[model samples]
Target: MSTQGLERQTRNYLSNNVPQIQQHGGNFEIREVDEEAGQVTVAIGGACSGCGIAPMTMKAIEHRLPESVDGVSEVKVVRAGGPRAAVMPSKIDEMDEMEEYEDYDPPF
Candidate 1:
């Protein structure tokens, strides 16, 4: 298959697999797909951010992505809430302002 084809397939694979990842505790975003280098940069957010199992999650991606989608040789996960995760935030995180909700002190 062509590079473009591989990129498209990989993109779809990432999108489709997001739901499954979310079930694990967090979400994933495809930051970039390099067909030639056979690598994908994904931003992991929510509970998965600082979770210790995050590496296992990444390992699963690194192993399965290439097998499921051609041209994907590696999966790079960028944490979105961990110490390192602070460097990269998913689009959702970027759009959300947690501070706005902090003002709501509901007294039941």
Candidate 2:
């Protein structure tokens, strides 16, 4: 299949099979489609930016896209804004700590 055709099929597959993406204010873009190599790169954006579950979503895409899209043997999913855009567990822990200290004031 041609690259454009594969890309369209991928979009349709994601839209129909992954409703959660849109429901959570997230959208995906086809970054690259190498028809010759049978590789497709997708970027997930919007509210999925700092989401903790994005890895799982990416994994699902990696696993499922191939099954649904003919000639797409590999799917590489990347976070739209990259690693800094992800909310790490340490950040959540820090936020929790800040909440605990909300009532305390340091005398300087």
Candidate 3:
């Protein structure tokens, strides 16, 4: 697929899944998509910023993204709170440096 097509597919996938993510008190922002590299960079924040299950969420994303969007090989995530590390295709980072979720209850 072309770079723009790949990017659009990824962004649309993310947008379509936003409600699911938000229901878990999380939000993902698509930072970029490197088509040549077949990678998607996502910023996850809100309640998911420092949650214990962030890695699980990332794992779910890692598994689902490729199925939802063609040509997507990996999903890289960044948290808003702190210790922002990229969650590569095979590994998830243990980022403990972040604010508690209570601080961002209402993100209006």
Q: Which candidate is the best by lDDT?
A: 2
What's each prediction's TM-score?
Answer: 0.57, 0.75, 0.61
After superposing candidate 2 on the true structure, give the runs of residues whose Cα lies further than 4 Å from its correct spot.
82-108
Q: Which stretches in model 3 have alpha-carbon errors above 4 Å?
A: 82-108
Could you arrange the candidates by TM-score from highest to lowest? Answer: 2, 3, 1
Error of 1 at 81 (Å): 4.0
Q: Residue 4 deviation, candidate 1, in Å?
A: 6.7
Clashing pairs in model 1, backbone N/Cα/C closer than 3 A: none
Once fitted onto the true fold, the runs of candidate 1 whose alpha carbons sit more than 4 angstroms away are 1-8, 15-20, 82-108
Stronger candidate by TM-score (2 vs 3): 2
Q: Candidate 1 vs candidate 3: which has greater lDDT?
A: 3
C-alpha lDDT (0 to 100) for residue 103 of candidate 3: 34
lDDT of 1 by residue, 22-74 (tens): 67566776777777788878777776664545555565666677889867788
> How far does residue 31 in candidate 2 sit from its true spot (Å)?
0.4
lDDT for position 88 in model 3:
34
lDDT of candidates 1 onward, in order: 0.62, 0.75, 0.66
Candidate 3: the clashing residue pairs are none
